[model samples]
Target: MVRNTLQMIAAGCGVLFVAGGAIASPAEVTVANAERRLEAGADISMTRWHVDAELILVLEKEASRKVTAYLQSRGRLRVVDVSVSINMDDRVILADFGPGFLPGPDEAEVFLHELAVTLRHYAEQAGLPIVGVDFRYQGKPLKSYYPAELAVPPRARIDARNQTALVSASHGLVRVHPALNWDYQRPDAFGFREDMITPPYGDALQRLLEERSGSGVNRARNRSQDPHPESNRPWDYMSSRYHLKTLLPDRTDIWNSLPNDTDADREVKEDIRARPLYANHLGVGTMISLHTNGHELGAIRGVEVYYHGDKPDDRPLAESVLCGMRELIRAQPGYENFPARQDASPGGHGENRIGTMPSVLVEIAYHSNAEDSVALQDPVFREASMKGVEKGVRLFREGKTCEPFVLQQIPDISLAAGTSQEITLPFAGHPQFPVTMEFTTANCSSPGACRPSKTTFDDPNTPITVLMRCRGSLTGDARWSVVLRDVDGVATAPVEFQHTCSKPGGSPAA
Candidate 1:
């Protein structure tokens, strides 16, 4: 049987009181809230309220008690604190449980399933139409549960006729994230995984992948390299027996018409055709395509921004992107050979020719070059390239360019009380270029919560480590912000760290 008595501590406005009484049944609690909403002509199916952290804690405590009661009726099990977050806009209930809340993985699955059902039942009884329940264990996402009725419909059944109806929307730029090769069946293309290319660069342009099709197509089969081994040689196999197969596809030679005979070429052509129609519908003024260059000779390196010769307007945007890339390439330690160039050819590739808006194809770097390939794999290098592209796009849009060297790193720090820890901050600009960064703490529970070894980063690639020492009495969380600046005190974007100091001899809060 469920417990009847309950104790609620009420503390607010400098007053504290303990109220002991019989707990109201779930049905009674539900009816009260429902009736109140109905009397006010409010939607009884949804509840929206702004709650502070203290109020959330109270709700969590109440939820834990009811959940524990329900579980205990079936079997004896220990219950711990539960964290709850309600998103009224999304109609989601996110619950996180304390560590070791479940006996094992198997039991965790079963317990969570039951917990979701129980919570949904109580929420429905309380007249709240929660669309889903997302549960986490020890701060890691565990599982998400949603009613069958709330599930999204599958895309396969949707009719294709209506897809192009919304293509006429206007946009400032229709960007395309391109793949390296057209061989969708194989992963060996140097240009494969170019889809991952969007974030770092798109973030720079102040645009998003959703704004345009980077590859100009959705299907993996549309943008591939020639299966003919000679046309699409792997970087590692370029100097080996792979050379015996055939000669590479020759689109660079001015005399040859751009190849569009292969199945892959036809597929790409059709895909490219659709982009212009979509761009016109959307009223986008310009287009940008992203790609990585490749050559049989690894000696060739650097970036090339290609624009359709017929489209004079594309020159300025291409030049801006090239200038940004030049700065980024020069900043890299051993990448001084990566010069930035612009190609404005009349008979450019199909991608450059198809867009109604002014368009440019940016070859970030040659993947065949060993050094370039290594840089391509580095997250910091990728971020720099993206930032450069972003600066160029900004210059084109606003008639001004602000290229600020960025310092990017993880934003959270945690240490045990009376202990010290060091954090390394990574920068995404020139390593040798001196940058001054100032770190300051805020919302510290006690004095002397954190200390910085140095306030400036003068060396390139040398990570700055901050020594954070927590007082023995310090607990809970604090924060620190680092501002990157030039020697003249010009500040760029500021990165922050969430400082967490654990209670003495206790684990820190998640």
Candidate 2:
């Protein structure tokens, strides 16, 4: 391997000569091997170096390591093809991802974003001068880029004088003339539709936003409420005092229709475009479109938040919302292990894309799944979700990102003696890869009985698999923990896992 370094700091940049071979496999491109060669006193900005096919291959593998691993685990999603290119003098790197790349999910954005970050980081580590990065799918440039779009911190229109918010339930009343509601429905399996569920959620969200902003405001608004007589009608009732601009089409806005009376799908399409327009008309700087997700696969259940993929400003709001929702939803008694499926991703929903300001659409829980359907009906769950939305909006305004990596709750395992099972521990994060992870086992029957695939690896983007073996008919429960430390040496709270070893033919624990 050639370790190229730039000695000509005052001269022009060095370019990479194309050298070709088979593309490096992902396993061969672990972060542990991407070591920086610069001296301790070296300046990162001044450093520049050459690149080649080998370097580009490794960079592409590492850049895609996270999303690829995640999709592989789920048994879905694929990257048709990908290639990386760099402009050293301009300090810009562009990655062209072929078809099946975006796939209309927010994880695609995260994947592209993470890939861009990793590409730049690897190049910088290789002593190359890189300042910005972008990604393209099928030859067309993506709307956002790293470092540049993120330069402006996201601040919602929350002023001390009169703060305002836009909380829209995904589907509302289409009962009136020329109106339409085309929400994802499963009327046979589930009683209430997405339309039925989201309105109350919007109401709760509006109330929570008011309560969180200031309960005193609610008290002062009682006088205003008296005159208005709080009916199912459109007015600036919330904006008048509570400063919450909630759009619950289910209740207040029933007569929402275009003069060109049309079918359900067209009406709904127009409605999707109209909501954000209404928000823009009111000068609302932020929007959260609440919704319940459904899938043909009823097993798919979890929180899924989304933002406009093209609009870089939208992601912080989505991520903050996911973090907040995860924080509270996981705290629920029976819902501790619920996943934030792909966390937040760009779903190309018009609700998010049509908005001018920072906007996010949250598929809070899946309505098609039995477990999630029950959760949507639970008041405790709804309250936690609403509170989380409020917190997310607040956090976004404060420019707070989520914890870089969070290990999802790993369930206890039961195995027959003399048997081994490989358990993949999934995670969610605002990923910045090339970080280190360390695992510690406690109360193991023997040293090699329980082992991680990699004890000390330098990546947290993918799931970690732990091999558990019940050596010599060992019968007992054991515990293990993980200490995730980033490059800066900041460690998160240790996450623990429990597993039980049962005798060969005996029944496992209940």
Per-candidate TM vs. native?
0.34, 0.44
- Model 2's C-alpha root-mean-square deviation from the true structure amounts to 17.9
Which runs in model 2 stand beyond 4 Å of their true positions?
1-162, 175-189, 215-264, 403-510
Q: Where in model 1 is the C-alpha error above 4 Å?
A: 1-264, 332-338, 342-347, 401-510
For residues 276-325, could you state the per-residue lDDT of candidate 1 as single tens digits?
A: 43334343555566656554435556666766544555667677777666
C-alpha RMSD for every candidate: 26.2, 17.9
Per-residue accuracy of model 2 over 223-323 as CA lDDT, tens digit each = 12233323332332222111122233442232242435444334343445556655555556577788787654465567878776566667778888887
**Per-residue lDDT value at 375 in model 1:** 73
Error of 1 at 167 (Å): 15
lDDT of 2 at 57: 67
